[model samples]
Target: MDAVNLEEQAARQQLFTTLYQKVFPAVAKYVSKCGGSFDEAKDVFQDALISYYEKSHTADVTINSSEGAYIYGTARYLWIKRYKQGSQTKQLDDSSAYSIIAETEAAPSEDKLLHFLETAGKRCMELLRSFYYDNLPMTRVAQLFGFSGVRSATVQKYKCIEKVRDTVKQKALTYEDFLE
Candidate 1:
Protein backbone atom coordinates (compact mmCIF):
# COMPACT_ATOMS: atom_id res chain seq x y z
CA MET A 1 0.00 0.00 0.00
CA ASP A 2 2.76 2.40 0.97
CA ALA A 3 4.73 1.35 -2.10
CA VAL A 4 1.73 2.07 -4.31
CA ASN A 5 1.38 5.49 -2.72
CA LEU A 6 5.08 6.14 -3.34
CA GLU A 7 4.76 5.17 -7.00
CA GLU A 8 1.77 7.45 -7.40
CA GLN A 9 3.79 10.28 -5.93
CA ALA A 10 6.69 9.55 -8.27
CA ALA A 11 4.45 9.48 -11.34
CA ARG A 12 2.70 12.66 -10.34
CA GLN A 13 6.07 14.35 -9.91
CA GLN A 14 7.21 13.21 -13.32
CA LEU A 15 4.03 14.51 -14.95
CA PHE A 16 4.30 17.86 -13.20
CA THR A 17 8.01 18.12 -13.98
CA THR A 18 7.42 17.46 -17.65
CA LEU A 19 4.55 19.90 -17.76
CA TYR A 20 6.63 22.52 -15.99
CA GLN A 21 9.47 22.15 -18.43
CA LYS A 22 7.19 22.32 -21.42
CA VAL A 23 4.89 25.11 -20.22
CA PHE A 24 6.72 27.23 -17.68
CA PRO A 25 8.78 29.50 -19.89
CA ALA A 26 5.71 30.93 -21.58
CA VAL A 27 3.77 31.15 -18.35
CA ALA A 28 6.65 32.75 -16.51
CA LYS A 29 7.10 35.37 -19.21
CA TYR A 30 3.39 36.18 -19.30
CA VAL A 31 3.12 36.34 -15.51
CA SER A 32 6.08 38.65 -15.19
CA LYS A 33 4.49 40.99 -17.68
CA CYS A 34 1.48 41.11 -15.35
CA GLY A 35 3.70 41.92 -12.33
CA GLY A 36 3.67 38.50 -10.67
CA SER A 37 6.48 37.07 -8.59
CA PHE A 38 8.20 33.74 -9.28
CA ASP A 39 6.31 32.13 -6.41
CA GLU A 40 3.04 33.57 -7.69
CA ALA A 41 3.87 32.18 -11.13
CA LYS A 42 4.43 28.75 -9.58
CA ASP A 43 1.20 28.92 -7.61
CA VAL A 44 -0.70 29.93 -10.71
CA PHE A 45 0.92 27.14 -12.71
CA GLN A 46 -0.01 24.46 -10.19
CA ASP A 47 -3.58 25.71 -9.97
CA ALA A 48 -3.76 25.81 -13.76
CA LEU A 49 -2.48 22.24 -14.05
CA ILE A 50 -5.00 21.01 -11.48
CA SER A 51 -7.75 22.84 -13.29
CA TYR A 52 -6.66 21.30 -16.60
CA TYR A 53 -6.57 17.82 -15.07
CA GLU A 54 -10.02 18.26 -13.58
CA LYS A 55 -11.41 19.58 -16.84
CA SER A 56 -9.90 16.73 -18.84
CA HIS A 57 -11.44 14.14 -16.54
CA THR A 58 -14.96 15.36 -17.20
CA ALA A 59 -16.86 13.49 -19.91
CA ASP A 60 -17.58 15.37 -23.15
CA VAL A 61 -15.41 18.31 -22.28
CA THR A 62 -13.77 20.06 -25.21
CA ILE A 63 -10.87 22.49 -24.89
CA ASN A 64 -10.72 25.07 -27.65
CA SER A 65 -7.18 26.01 -26.73
CA SER A 66 -4.07 23.85 -26.84
CA GLU A 67 -2.88 22.40 -23.51
CA GLY A 68 -0.14 25.00 -23.11
CA ALA A 69 -2.55 27.76 -24.04
CA TYR A 70 -5.16 26.44 -21.65
CA ILE A 71 -2.60 26.31 -18.89
CA TYR A 72 -1.37 29.82 -19.68
CA GLY A 73 -4.88 31.21 -19.86
CA THR A 74 -5.90 29.52 -16.65
CA ALA A 75 -2.78 30.76 -14.94
CA ARG A 76 -3.44 34.30 -16.18
CA TYR A 77 -6.98 34.11 -14.84
CA LEU A 78 -5.75 32.80 -11.49
CA TRP A 79 -3.20 35.60 -11.32
CA ILE A 80 -5.97 38.13 -11.81
CA LYS A 81 -8.02 36.42 -9.15
CA ARG A 82 -5.07 36.54 -6.77
CA TYR A 83 -4.58 40.21 -7.53
CA LYS A 84 -8.21 40.93 -6.77
CA GLN A 85 -7.91 39.07 -3.49
CA GLY A 86 -4.72 40.93 -2.66
CA SER A 87 -6.31 44.29 -3.32
CA GLN A 88 -9.18 43.53 -0.96
CA THR A 89 -6.89 42.66 1.92
CA LYS A 90 -7.64 45.04 4.82
CA GLN A 91 -4.94 47.48 5.68
CA LEU A 92 -4.10 46.27 9.17
CA ASP A 93 -0.49 47.32 8.66
CA ASP A 94 1.96 46.77 5.85
CA SER A 95 3.56 43.85 7.64
CA SER A 96 0.36 42.26 8.94
CA ALA A 97 -0.94 41.36 5.51
CA TYR A 98 2.44 39.89 4.60
CA SER A 99 2.54 37.89 7.85
CA ILE A 100 -1.01 36.66 7.34
CA ILE A 101 -0.29 35.69 3.75
CA ALA A 102 2.90 33.97 4.82
CA GLU A 103 1.06 32.00 7.48
CA THR A 104 -1.73 31.09 5.11
CA GLU A 105 0.84 29.84 2.64
CA ALA A 106 3.11 28.00 5.08
CA ALA A 107 1.12 26.68 8.04
CA PRO A 108 -0.80 23.89 6.38
CA SER A 109 2.14 22.21 4.66
CA GLU A 110 4.53 22.64 7.56
CA ASP A 111 2.03 21.34 10.11
CA LYS A 112 0.93 18.38 8.03
CA LEU A 113 4.50 17.40 7.15
CA LEU A 114 5.52 17.63 10.79
CA HIS A 115 2.52 15.52 11.77
CA PHE A 116 3.41 12.94 9.12
CA LEU A 117 7.04 12.76 10.20
CA GLU A 118 5.96 12.50 13.79
CA THR A 119 4.23 9.27 12.81
CA ALA A 120 6.40 7.80 10.06
CA GLY A 121 9.88 9.06 10.86
CA LYS A 122 10.34 8.29 14.49
CA ARG A 123 14.05 8.98 14.45
CA CYS A 124 13.54 12.23 12.60
CA MET A 125 10.81 13.30 14.97
CA GLU A 126 12.95 12.41 17.94
CA LEU A 127 15.95 14.22 16.57
CA LEU A 128 13.99 17.32 15.58
CA ARG A 129 12.06 17.41 18.81
CA SER A 130 15.17 17.01 20.91
CA PHE A 131 17.10 19.67 19.01
CA TYR A 132 14.29 22.15 18.55
CA TYR A 133 11.52 21.61 21.10
CA ASP A 134 13.63 20.28 23.92
CA ASN A 135 16.48 22.70 23.14
CA LEU A 136 19.04 19.96 23.42
CA PRO A 137 22.59 21.04 22.62
CA MET A 138 24.50 19.43 19.78
CA THR A 139 26.85 17.52 22.12
CA ARG A 140 23.93 16.13 24.09
CA VAL A 141 22.07 15.16 20.93
CA ALA A 142 25.20 13.43 19.66
CA GLN A 143 25.34 11.46 22.89
CA LEU A 144 21.66 10.62 22.66
CA PHE A 145 21.80 9.58 18.99
CA GLY A 146 25.15 7.80 19.55
CA PHE A 147 26.85 9.86 16.83
CA SER A 148 30.21 9.92 18.67
CA GLY A 149 30.65 13.73 18.22
CA VAL A 150 28.81 16.95 17.50
CA ARG A 151 30.12 17.15 13.92
CA SER A 152 28.83 13.71 12.95
CA ALA A 153 25.56 14.29 14.76
CA THR A 154 25.21 17.69 13.12
CA VAL A 155 25.76 16.18 9.68
CA GLN A 156 23.13 13.49 10.29
CA LYS A 157 20.76 16.11 11.66
CA TYR A 158 21.10 18.23 8.52
CA LYS A 159 20.54 15.20 6.29
CA CYS A 160 17.37 14.40 8.20
CA ILE A 161 16.27 18.02 7.83
CA GLU A 162 16.88 17.99 4.08
CA LYS A 163 14.82 14.83 3.64
CA VAL A 164 11.87 16.16 5.65
CA ARG A 165 12.09 19.60 4.04
CA ASP A 166 12.06 18.12 0.54
CA THR A 167 9.01 16.04 1.38
CA VAL A 168 7.30 19.09 2.83
CA LYS A 169 8.09 21.20 -0.24
CA GLN A 170 6.87 18.62 -2.75
CA LYS A 171 3.74 17.81 -0.76
CA ALA A 172 3.01 21.49 -0.45
CA LEU A 173 2.95 21.85 -4.23
CA THR A 174 0.27 19.10 -4.48
CA TYR A 175 -2.29 21.34 -2.75
CA GLU A 176 -2.76 18.56 -0.20
CA ASP A 177 -4.55 20.95 2.11
CA PHE A 178 -7.05 21.74 -0.64
CA LEU A 179 -8.22 18.12 -0.47
CA GLU A 180 -8.98 18.43 3.23
Candidate 2:
Protein backbone atom coordinates (compact mmCIF):
# COMPACT_ATOMS: atom_id res chain seq x y z
CA MET A 1 0.00 0.00 0.00
CA ASP A 2 2.86 2.40 0.80
CA ALA A 3 4.57 1.63 -2.50
CA VAL A 4 1.33 2.26 -4.37
CA ASN A 5 0.83 5.57 -2.57
CA LEU A 6 4.40 6.60 -3.37
CA GLU A 7 3.87 5.79 -7.03
CA GLU A 8 0.69 7.81 -7.07
CA GLN A 9 2.49 10.80 -5.50
CA ALA A 10 5.26 10.57 -8.08
CA ALA A 11 2.72 10.50 -10.88
CA ARG A 12 0.97 13.54 -9.46
CA GLN A 13 4.30 15.36 -9.15
CA GLN A 14 5.16 14.62 -12.75
CA LEU A 15 1.76 15.82 -13.85
CA PHE A 16 2.13 19.07 -11.94
CA THR A 17 5.60 19.65 -13.36
CA THR A 18 4.34 19.08 -16.89
CA LEU A 19 1.42 21.42 -16.36
CA TYR A 20 3.64 24.20 -14.96
CA GLN A 21 6.08 23.87 -17.83
CA LYS A 22 3.26 24.17 -20.33
CA VAL A 23 1.39 27.02 -18.66
CA PHE A 24 3.96 29.43 -17.21
CA PRO A 25 5.02 31.04 -20.49
CA ALA A 26 1.40 31.63 -21.42
CA VAL A 27 0.75 33.27 -18.06
CA ALA A 28 3.89 35.37 -18.40
CA LYS A 29 2.69 36.57 -21.79
CA TYR A 30 -0.64 37.48 -20.27
CA VAL A 31 1.06 39.45 -17.49
CA SER A 32 3.28 41.34 -19.93
CA LYS A 33 0.29 42.13 -22.13
CA CYS A 34 -1.45 43.61 -19.10
CA GLY A 35 1.23 46.35 -18.50
CA GLY A 36 3.71 44.30 -16.46
CA SER A 37 7.35 43.64 -17.36
CA PHE A 38 8.94 40.17 -17.42
CA ASP A 39 10.23 40.54 -13.88
CA GLU A 40 6.77 41.45 -12.64
CA ALA A 41 5.32 38.56 -14.59
CA LYS A 42 7.87 36.25 -13.00
CA ASP A 43 6.85 37.53 -9.56
CA VAL A 44 3.18 36.97 -10.35
CA PHE A 45 3.97 33.52 -11.67
CA GLN A 46 5.82 32.66 -8.45
CA ASP A 47 2.79 33.78 -6.44
CA ALA A 48 0.53 31.68 -8.64
CA LEU A 49 2.75 28.67 -8.04
CA ILE A 50 2.22 29.08 -4.29
CA SER A 51 -1.52 29.45 -4.85
CA TYR A 52 -1.51 26.28 -6.95
CA TYR A 53 0.41 24.43 -4.24
CA GLU A 54 -2.08 25.48 -1.58
CA LYS A 55 -5.00 24.44 -3.74
CA SER A 56 -3.41 21.11 -4.57
CA HIS A 57 -2.84 20.28 -0.91
CA THR A 58 -6.51 20.65 0.01
CA ALA A 59 -8.50 17.62 1.19
CA ASP A 60 -10.98 18.13 -1.64
CA VAL A 61 -8.12 18.13 -4.16
CA THR A 62 -9.14 16.85 -7.56
CA ILE A 63 -7.69 17.29 -11.02
CA ASN A 64 -11.11 17.83 -12.52
CA SER A 65 -10.18 21.47 -13.20
CA SER A 66 -7.50 22.07 -15.79
CA GLU A 67 -4.17 23.15 -14.25
CA GLY A 68 -3.89 25.87 -16.89
CA ALA A 69 -7.20 27.33 -15.78
CA TYR A 70 -6.19 27.39 -12.14
CA ILE A 71 -2.86 29.09 -12.82
CA TYR A 72 -4.33 31.59 -15.28
CA GLY A 73 -7.03 32.52 -12.81
CA THR A 74 -4.47 33.12 -10.05
CA ALA A 75 -2.23 35.11 -12.40
CA ARG A 76 -5.15 37.29 -13.40
CA TYR A 77 -5.95 37.97 -9.78
CA LEU A 78 -2.33 38.90 -9.12
CA TRP A 79 -2.15 41.18 -12.14
CA ILE A 80 -5.36 42.93 -11.13
CA LYS A 81 -3.91 43.45 -7.66
CA ARG A 82 -0.74 44.87 -9.17
CA TYR A 83 -2.73 47.25 -11.36
CA LYS A 84 -4.91 48.51 -8.54
CA GLN A 85 -1.88 49.08 -6.36
CA GLY A 86 -0.01 50.98 -9.07
CA SER A 87 -2.83 53.27 -10.08
CA GLN A 88 -2.88 56.64 -8.29
CA THR A 89 -6.38 57.74 -9.05
CA LYS A 90 -9.22 56.09 -7.19
CA GLN A 91 -12.32 55.28 -9.18
CA LEU A 92 -14.80 53.06 -7.46
CA ASP A 93 -16.35 50.23 -9.40
CA ASP A 94 -18.73 47.74 -7.82
CA SER A 95 -16.88 44.63 -8.95
CA SER A 96 -13.49 45.68 -7.54
CA ALA A 97 -14.67 47.34 -4.28
CA TYR A 98 -14.18 44.17 -2.23
CA SER A 99 -10.47 43.95 -3.13
CA ILE A 100 -9.85 47.71 -2.98
CA ILE A 101 -9.35 47.82 0.76
CA ALA A 102 -6.17 45.77 0.64
CA GLU A 103 -4.79 47.73 -2.30
CA THR A 104 -5.45 51.19 -0.83
CA GLU A 105 -3.55 50.58 2.40
CA ALA A 106 -0.17 51.69 1.01
CA ALA A 107 1.30 53.73 -1.78
CA PRO A 108 3.42 51.86 -4.32
CA SER A 109 6.57 53.77 -3.36
CA GLU A 110 6.08 52.80 0.28
CA ASP A 111 5.62 49.19 -0.81
CA LYS A 112 8.82 49.26 -2.85
CA LEU A 113 10.68 50.99 -0.04
CA LEU A 114 9.42 48.39 2.43
CA HIS A 115 10.52 45.59 0.15
CA PHE A 116 13.97 47.17 -0.13
CA LEU A 117 14.20 47.61 3.63
CA GLU A 118 13.26 43.95 4.11
CA THR A 119 16.03 42.90 1.72
CA ALA A 120 18.62 45.06 3.54
CA GLY A 121 18.80 43.29 6.96
CA LYS A 122 16.42 42.08 9.62
CA ARG A 123 17.54 44.59 12.26
CA CYS A 124 17.36 47.52 9.87
CA MET A 125 13.97 46.40 8.60
CA GLU A 126 12.59 46.11 12.11
CA LEU A 127 13.97 49.49 13.17
CA LEU A 128 12.63 51.31 10.14
CA ARG A 129 9.25 49.61 10.28
CA SER A 130 8.89 50.38 13.95
CA PHE A 131 9.69 54.04 13.40
CA TYR A 132 7.86 54.67 10.15
CA TYR A 133 5.06 52.19 9.65
CA ASP A 134 4.25 51.73 13.31
CA ASN A 135 4.85 55.43 14.04
CA LEU A 136 6.81 54.73 17.18
CA PRO A 137 8.86 57.41 18.90
CA MET A 138 12.64 57.14 18.84
CA THR A 139 12.82 56.49 22.60
CA ARG A 140 10.07 53.92 22.40
CA VAL A 141 11.62 52.23 19.37
CA ALA A 142 14.99 52.20 21.15
CA GLN A 143 13.52 50.61 24.26
CA LEU A 144 11.58 48.05 22.29
CA PHE A 145 14.43 47.09 19.98
CA GLY A 146 17.19 47.23 22.63
CA PHE A 147 18.95 50.28 21.31
CA SER A 148 20.95 52.34 23.84
CA GLY A 149 18.82 55.50 23.75
CA VAL A 150 16.81 57.92 21.59
CA ARG A 151 19.91 59.42 19.92
CA SER A 152 21.23 55.99 19.08
CA ALA A 153 17.83 55.00 17.76
CA THR A 154 17.69 58.15 15.68
CA VAL A 155 21.12 57.47 14.18
CA GLN A 156 20.24 53.85 13.49
CA LYS A 157 17.01 54.90 11.86
CA TYR A 158 18.86 57.42 9.66
CA LYS A 159 21.34 54.74 8.59
CA CYS A 160 18.48 52.36 7.76
CA ILE A 161 16.75 55.09 5.74
CA GLU A 162 19.98 55.75 3.84
CA LYS A 163 20.35 52.04 3.10
CA VAL A 164 16.78 51.89 1.81
CA ARG A 165 17.32 55.03 -0.28
CA ASP A 166 20.49 53.61 -1.79
CA THR A 167 18.74 50.36 -2.64
CA VAL A 168 15.89 52.26 -4.28
CA LYS A 169 18.33 54.44 -6.24
CA GLN A 170 20.18 51.38 -7.46
CA LYS A 171 16.98 49.65 -8.53
CA ALA A 172 15.77 52.81 -10.26
CA LEU A 173 19.08 53.14 -12.11
CA THR A 174 18.42 49.88 -13.92
CA TYR A 175 15.41 51.46 -15.62
CA GLU A 176 16.70 55.05 -16.06
CA ASP A 177 19.41 57.32 -14.71
CA PHE A 178 17.94 59.20 -11.74
CA LEU A 179 20.18 62.26 -12.11
CA GLU A 180 19.24 62.82 -15.74
Instruction: After the best TM-score superposition of candidate 1, give how far the Cα of residue 78 lies from its true spot, in angstroms.
Output: 0.5
Worst 10 residues of 2 by lDDT: 171-180
Q: Summarize candidate 1's per-residue lDDT along 26-132 as a digit string, tens digits.
A: 88888899888888888889999999878976888988888888898898888898889998975788799788887676545565656756643788789988998
Best by TM-score: 1
What lDDT would each prediction earn against the true structure?
Answer: 0.82, 0.79
Q: Which pairs in model 2 have colliding backbones?
A: none
The lDDT of model 1 is 0.82
TM match of model 2 to true structure: 0.40
Provide the TM-score for each candidate, comma-separated: 0.44, 0.40
lDDT of 2 at 123: 92
Clashing pairs in 1: none
Per-residue accuracy of model 2 over 1-180 as CA lDDT, tens digit each:
699999988987887688668888998889888878988887887788778877887989765677788887888898898888888566779868866775565335645445666866899988887887899988899999888889888988888788877887777644222212
**Deviating ranges (above 4 Å) for candidate 1:** 1-13, 92-180
